[model samples]
Target: MSSGTSNGEHRYVIIGNGIAGTTAAEHIRKADGAASIKLLTNEPHPLYNRIALPPFLKQKIARQKVTIHNEAWHAERNIDLMLEQTAVRVDPLAREVYLASGATLPYDTLLIATGGRANPLPNANGLQNVFNFQTLDDSLAILAQIERSESAVVIGGSYISYELTEAFRSRGLQTTWLMRGPRFLRRVLEAEGGALVDRIAGRHGVQVIHGVEIAEVRGQDGKVSEVVTSDGRVFPCQLLGVGVGITRNVDFLAGSGIETSSAVLTDQCLRSNVPGVFAAGDSAEYYDPYVGHPILMGTWDNATNHGKIVAQNMLGGEVPYDDVPTYSTTLFHNRIMAFGATPESNPDVEAVMWLDEASESYRRLFFQGERMVGGVIIGQRKGFPKLIDLIKQRTPIPVAEREQVLAQSVQ
Candidate 1:
C-alpha cells in the first residue's frame, strides 16, 4: 500500500474542485480523520466562490476577495490537492483513475463531483470577444475584452446571459440582449416576472430581442463587428456573450459501470448504482425526498449541502439529502429568486401569482392540492424564508387562501 494509506485506513479520491467536491473533502477529514484524501481538478487555483463572479466580472470587487479556500487552507486540512491534473479515464474493474499526465490513482471510495461545462454557440470559431460566462477565467477574459469593446450581443435567456448583460452594461457598453425565447427566463419565471426583466433591460438601453436565432457572426479585420440573426435583422456588436446552458461533464464515465442520464443518477443518499462510487454537484441528479422524485439542482447551497450529506453516507451514515433548492440572481436591476419546483419544473402544480406593475415586483406561489410545492419570487426577497418554510413543511394552504397567504407575507 502507498504510504498515504494504512491498514485500517481507506483512500478517498474526489474529482473536481468546486464547492461540492471541496466541501466533501473538508467534511470527510473531520469525520474520518485517518482516511487518505486526494482532490483533483483541472483548475490551477484553489476552490473559489463561483457565485461571486458576477460582482467580480463587474469590477465591483477585487479578484482577491473572490477566492474562498486557498492552497494553504487545503494543506492545513491535509487534502492532497492535485492541480491542473485532468482525469482521462476511469476503470471500475481495477478501481483506478487514469490522469492525462500518464498517472494512475487508486481509490477505495470515489466521488465524481465533476461539474458541467458551459455550452458554446455554434460556428463561433476562435472569434475574438466571444465567451461563455461560467468560470473565473472566462469572466477575466470578458473583463479584459470590455476594456476595449462596445455594443455587445448577449445570447440566451438564462442567468449567465443576464450576468453578462449586467457586466457589459455596467462597463458602459452598448448592450443588445438576444434570445430564442419570448421573454427572459421563459422556462422558470412567470410572464409578469419575465416582462419585468425585459423592462429592466430596456431601462438600461439594452435592446432585448426574442425568438431569433444567430445566422452568422461577421467580423472586421479579424475581430467581431456584428451579428446576423436568422430573421435577417443585423445588429452591430463588438462582443458576443453566449450563455445557452451547460452540458454536464460525464464523458469520462462511459463503460465505468456508472449509470448516466442528463446527469449522474444518484439515490436519496447521493450514491451511484456502482458500489463505493458517488456523484454530486451540478452533475448529480439525486433523488429528492421532498419532491419524491429525481432532480438535478444547480444551486450553490444545494451542492454545498450535498457535499456534507454525501460525505456522511460515504462514511456509512444513512443521512438522506433534503432541501428546497433555491437559485437567486439579479438581472439588470431586479433581484430574482426561484425556490422549490416552479411551473416549468412541474406543470401539473397550480400557480398563484401577484404582479405589482408599478413597483415592477412579482411573486408566484406554486401548490399541489392544498400543499405548497414551490414558488418563484422576483423583485421582492423579504418573504422568501416563509415561502421556503411553506414548501419544506409542505404547509397546507387552501387554493382560495393562497393569494392571501402570499399577500400577507409580502406585506
Candidate 2:
C-alpha cells in the first residue's frame, strides 16, 4: 500500500478491486480532491476485465491489455490501495471495516464491490482435477492443463463453458460439454438459438451431452481420471472443467445489517438498505426496470455502470442507473447478442424467429403485444444498436413490419 498525507479526516473505504471498486475510487477522487480514499482488494494485481480471460487463454490477446490500470496510476492520484488484504467483517452502524489481519479501518462511506465467486463442483471430494474459470490464477492453471492434455470434460453449458470448450478445441484438445438442461444456454437463449450454438460446437469437433448431472469425480493417485454422472455414465478425461456459475461474495456481510437475497439488494441509486452503505457489481441484486424485479447481472457492463452510479450517490450526487440490460458472447464461429428480459423470464411474452439453418443465421424478436421486450441475434452483427434503442425507448413495431425491421440494416 502507498503512503498518503495524514490529513486526519474521515476516509472512504472500498472493498474489492474489480471494475466497480476502481470506478468508485476514480469517481470519488474526481468529485472531491481532498477526500481520502482507500481501496482494499484480495487480489494482488490491479483491476482487469474478467470477461476477457477466455480470449487471453486462447492467446488471442495479452494479459496486460485486459488490465484496467496500473498501480502507479492509483499512487499518482494519492489513493491508497491495499492489495492482497481481505475485509472480513463490516460494522455498518459504526461505519468501520475489520480486516482478516485484525486491522480495523473507519469509513465515512463504504461500498461493497466484493463481486462474486465461481460456483464449485458438487462433491469435490478432494478431487484434484476439478477446476473453475473465474480468476487469472484459474485461467493460468486451465491453460497449463490444456497444453498437457489431449481431452477434457467441461461441466455446465453456459457461456463460460462454451468459451472453455472453444479454448480447449483451439489447442487441439477434444472437448466434451456436460449440461444439466435440455439445451445449451437455455436460460438466456431460445431453443432455436441454442440449437444453432449446439451445431456450431459440433462443427468444432466437440461433444455435447444434455440432461445429465455430474455425480462424483473418480480419481487415481489424487488426480482426476473419470467423472461419473447421475445417469450412471462415466466420462474419461484427464482434465475436468466446471463452470456451473457464480455465487455472490457477500459472506463477509453476514453481520453487516445489509439486506441480501442471493446478493445485496440495492435501489436505483445503488444504495443498500442501510444508509451510508452502497453495493455494486456482481454482488448487487438490483431492480430491473424492464423485468420489474430484483436480478443479479454478472456482466462487465453492469459492474462499470453500477460503480459510476454508486460513486455519484456516495458524493451526494443523484444519478439513477436504469439502462437496458445487455450482454454478448462469441463462440465457435458465431456471435450472440441479447438484451432485456428473455421470453422465459415472462411466460406471457412471445418470440418470433427468423432462421436460415444452412447459413447458421438466426434472428429472434421477443414481444409483449406490439412492444419489443427482448430477443437475440446469432451469426449477425448488424442492427444490434437498433435493437438496444428499441428496447430502451420501449418502441413498438407493427406486426406487418416486424419481420422487415428485423432484417433491415441501420443506415
Candidate 3:
C-alpha cells in the first residue's frame, strides 16, 4: 500500500482488536519497528479468547482466564490500542477512516477485521433473559441469569445454539433445543451423523424438538417467559439462548469501493479489490486454493492464520493462504470434528458415510471427483489426523477402496 516508503514510515490502522487484528499488529511491529500501529475496537476490554467463553459460562474457568491480552500487553508492544471506538465509515479514495465519535484517522494501509455480529432473534430485542452469547459480557450476563433460571430454551442449529444447550444442561437446568431443521448440521452432516448427535444429546437429558420456528416470544415484566412456535406449541423457560448465526460487519464499507458479499471479497493473497485495503478474520471471504473457491470460515485457527498471512501481503509479499482449517468440540463425552470444505461450505462435493451405532461413532468423507476434500466425524476422533492429512494432500482414492478407508481407523 505504501509504495517507495520505508517499512518504518508506514502507518497501519487495524479495525477490530480481535485475534486476527491483534495478531497482524503484533507481526507488523515485529517486521517494521517504527511503523505507527493503531488497533481500534468497540469493546471495552482488550483481546479475549472468544473460544473460552463457553467454559467460562459453564463455570469451568475463572473470568480472568478468558482474557488473552490486556491493555498492558498492547502497551508493552507499543501498539496504540483504541478501546470503545467504533469505525463508522471508510473513504478509500482519501485513505481515511471516520469514527463514530466524528474523528478521522489516516492510514497507509488498513485491515478490516471487524468480524461479524450475532444475529438477533426477531421480536426478542429489548427483553430481558433473552441472550446471544458472542462476547465476554454476554457470557457474564448469561451466567447471572443461570443462577436464577430454572429452565432454558435454545434456538437454531448452529454451534452457538449447541453451546447454550450444553451449558444449560450442564448446569442442571431443564433445557430444550429447538430447530427448524430435522437434524443438527443439516447441511453438513447426513441423517446418520445427525441422529448420532441427537442420541448423545438425549443421553444428556436435552429435549430436542425439530421442525419448528419461533412464532412469538412471550415475556413477563419485560423478561422472557415462554416461546411459542409456528405450530402453536409453547415451551416455557426463564432464559432463551438464540444462535441464528452472524452477519459480517461490513455495512460501513458499503459505499467505499471495497467489494463485499456476505463478507469482504478478497483474492488468495487476502487483498481486497481496493488498493491499500485488506480483510481478515470472519469479515473476509477469501479464495481458498484447496477447495478452488472462496469460502467464509469463522474458526479461531482460520482467523489467526489470516492475520499472520495477510500481514506478509500487506508488507508487499505475495503469500497465498493455504492453511487447512479445522474445528472440534465434545458433545456429552463424544467428540465432533469438521475439517476443510464440507457440504455446508461446498455443496458440489460427493459424500460417503460410515456408521457404527454400537460404538456411537460415525464419519462422512467428502470428495471432489477422486480427491478427498473434507470430512465430518461424530462420536469418534480416532481417524481424525489421517483424514486431515488426506484432505491437505488432496489424495485420490480409488472408488472401490473408499469404504475400506472409512473403516480402517477403528478396525
Top model by lDDT, which number?
Answer: 3
Quality of model 3 by C-alpha lDDT? 0.89
lDDT of each: 0.85, 0.82, 0.89
Residue lDDT tens for model 3, 1-411: 463245447888999999999999999888988888999999999999998998888888998999999899999999999999999999989889999999999888999999999999987857899999899889989999999999999999978899999999999999999999988888888888888889989999999988999989999999999999889999999999999899999999999989999999999999999988999999999998778889998889999999999888888889999888888776777878888888877989888898899989888888887778888887758877887888788788887777777888556
Instruction: List CA RMSD, all candidates.
Output: 2.1, 3.3, 1.7
The alpha-carbon lDDT assigned to residue 388 of candidate 1 equals: 80
Q: What stretches of model 2 exceed 4 Å from their correct place?
A: 1-10, 343-349, 368-370, 396-411
Report the C-alpha lDDT of model 1 over 256-364, residue by residue, as the tens digit: 8799898899999899998888898998989976566777777898889989888888777788888888888886677888888765656677778888988778888
lDDT of 2 by residue, 1-411 (tens): 122237745478999989999998998898878888999999878888888898898889997877878899999887899989999999988778999989998888889999988899877678776789989888888878877787889988777787788888888887888999988767656787787788898988999988998888898888888888889988888888888888889998997789998989988888889988888988898877765677677778889988888898888777878886667778678787767667544556677777778778787877766778777778766777778788788777787777777767322
Off by over 4 Å in 3: 1-8
Q: Estimate each model's TM-score.
A: 0.95, 0.92, 0.97
Name the 10 consecutive residues with the lowest summed lDDT in model 2. 1-10
Better of 2 and 3 by lDDT: 3
Residue 218 error, candidate 3, Å: 0.4
